[model samples]
Target: MNAFAPTRTSWRPRSLRWQVMAAVIAINLCAALAALVVIIANARRATEIEMLSSLAIGARFVQETVERIADEQGGTASLAQLPLHINGLRHVRIRIEDAQGNGIDLAPASHDEADGDADEVPDWFTALITVPPAERDIPVVENGRRIGEVRVAGEASDEIAEVWEDMTSLAVLALIVNIAILAALYLVLGRLLRPLKTLSQGLQELEEGRFDHRLPPPAFRELALLAERFNALGAALRLARDDNRRLNERLVQVQDDERRQIASELHDELGPCLFGLRANLESLERMTAYAPVASAAERVATMVDILDRIQGLNRRLLRRIRPMSLGHVPFAAVIADLVADFEAHSAGRRFDFVSEGLAEHYGDSIEITVFRCVQETVTNALRHGGARHISIELRHDAASGMLKMAVSDDGSGMRANALPGLGLIGIEERIGALGGRWHIGSTDPKGTRIDILIPLPPANVQAESAERTVIQ
Candidate 1:
């Protein structure tokens, strides 16, 4: 399995702003729920207390009314009006009953429309807030004769209805306030986090190798410090990249200088020495040819043959060390000669060289890099890839100021898991130093293809003027 693949637990909001907003909303909802629960519990307790208190007061009032009525002359008859006296009492009911079983019941007046809709409070809510029924009995007597009793019972439907209305109003108000808070928070957070988005964009630029990208200071102190650090990092990366490019270019120049020195030494010193040795051997063979000794003549001829082989080997080494004709010949012509040499040595192998829009020369570094890259690629194709057919395409686009080259060979493709060898890595360094790009890939059916694009310097003013003059 891929190590970088995200697992189920790795899931998360893709944006910081949304993540923060979600967290805020969750916290607000939880707090609202907690507050609601507290309000409901407190309302239930307050309603229960109010109902019991009202019933106790009503019972005391009824007891006093009964004793007053019984002391009067028409006390038994006046007991019928006790219900009317207690009719206006809140959260309680009263009833007066005599020995004959006749009674008048009193209840608080219905004000469903004036108070609020009773249906607004559900049955479950009413049941949850309901208090135990409170009741009290007051005896009625006239001249010490038993008569009737007054009963007071607690009632809480009206009280519960009032509490439910207050709760709903508070709930609606809280909802509106929370929505307003969330909206303002969202806007403020977006404004606060906008700098982070800019920082994100700057990081992406860095990833794409645009090291010169910089971030501006944000308003927040923490973000401003972070931006300062980001700018410093970009500056450091840009300086490092420039230094590396210069170092690679210097290294390439040094390598070329060394190769040129070695080639010069071989040509000036070894070439003449090999010639002298061959001359001496040929002269020795001539002197021994006239002798009567056949073994001496055979030895001289073998030595002469060995000397020829040595001279040939030395020439090959010189060619490998440095291309002598590079500066003296056109770049395209030099490449063509290289292909010709390869074909001559490798039997039954084909080499094709194509060129278009190429000038007579580019700078020393550009020329040398291209030559070395081509040389390395071809050698690898023959030695490792076992390629029998190779093709090179060189093109120079003056308008775009780029020199493009593609080298392809029909051979076994590179292995999927194979790492780049030293030669390929060197090519990369060389190309990167020139601010160019190169790609190597396996060809269709078979073989490997390498493509290189190097930016070309602008043409000389004098050369361009002269060409225009000639054209005019």
Candidate 2:
């Protein structure tokens, strides 16, 4: 048998922890993005409204000043005397064009700081916070004809710089808040899910027949309910396991007792009776021979033949009921004996046995399960499949700790639609009891094969446990 080891693959299934964390982070990121969009949009709209209001109010003030100054006693000469621009401000550019077309310019600084101020923040942030510029014109007239024009537009370098600062601060604050919220969410989820980890480990151990793992009471309502349920489940399993162990023990005891009784009856009650009958027949045959009675002698020989046949039938029945020698012989040696016996009993029928990398030893339960499965399959093949030749192969995979045995017959093979009979069902139950599995192999003119695989525990764990056995 070639090594049937499975190749290891790289992809691993995601666990509950990572899945939950991913979902949490994904949801938080989406919420943060939505909030950011809304906040920036609202702030930008508010900035535009405020900038437009500043422009409107500044225009009204300029219009009122031009009208008031031109009406002064000095008239147009005094118009130049008025301070049209504020100190230390370069954003608001004030220009007055007189009726003579001469332009008067008033700016605290010559250079427009709004156009080329040192970049306060990144271009993207500045652009996001800036509002569209607004301009308004007011015509100044002394009486009826227009004297001069006062134009006002909002241009605040300090305002744009201040907006840039506010935006940067808002972004930093939002980032810190999002980080804090996500971090807290991560920690809270980890803490809340702590019980799940413990519960998972406990369930795994429970599945492996370790029923002692228990969960303590949790403070949270949902977790506490889950913990209580888990603990209860463990307790139920432990109770069921103990009960099953007792039942199995009693069943085993009864089976062993029946075997002993049958063996004793076959040996003590039937042995002497068959011996006496054989002795009586031998005496009669000798007496007939001495008397020269041919007919009598033939009858006596026929009687002796009948007696021998009965004894042979009895022994066969006993072997079928309980192969007590199976317990005494080596497991591998017993299989070799089975092949020899099958070939010896039937003419023109062959039984071939082969093994590959099989351990020289195993627990008694393993021995029993292997032997019974082979025996039943072989019987089914000969009796039902009309098999004349059978082949058996045994293998033990060290890496996987599994014992694999295959039994096949070169015969009519099994029908596809045929349901399993008593023997096959018995085989299935036997293997299941040992926590093993079996496969009914292919059909047709090819052959019939029955394969059984049993996982072997560590060498230290023997069949000493009461539950580690089969009744048959």
**Candidate 2 per-residue lDDT over residues 1-472, each given as its tens digit:** 2343321121136655566767767887797689767766776777677667777776766766665666664344243544543223334555666778677777535544555552555676567766777777777665566776666666644455666666568778878887797788778878888888888888998989889888888778999999999989999999999977866776677578658877886777567657766776776767775656776666576667767766765765656665666667656667777667677677788788876665555767878778778878888888887887788988766667788899888778777799876567667777888889999876556779888889888872332211111111
Candidate 2 positional error at 68, Å: 1.2
Question: Pick by lDDT: which candidate is best?
Answer: 1
Candidate with the greatest TM-score versus the true structure:
1
lDDT of each structure? 0.78, 0.70
Candidate 1 residue 119 C-alpha distance from true site, Å:
4.0
The predictions' CA RMSDs to the true structure, in order, are: 18.7, 16.5
Q: Candidate 1: lDDT of 377?
A: 96
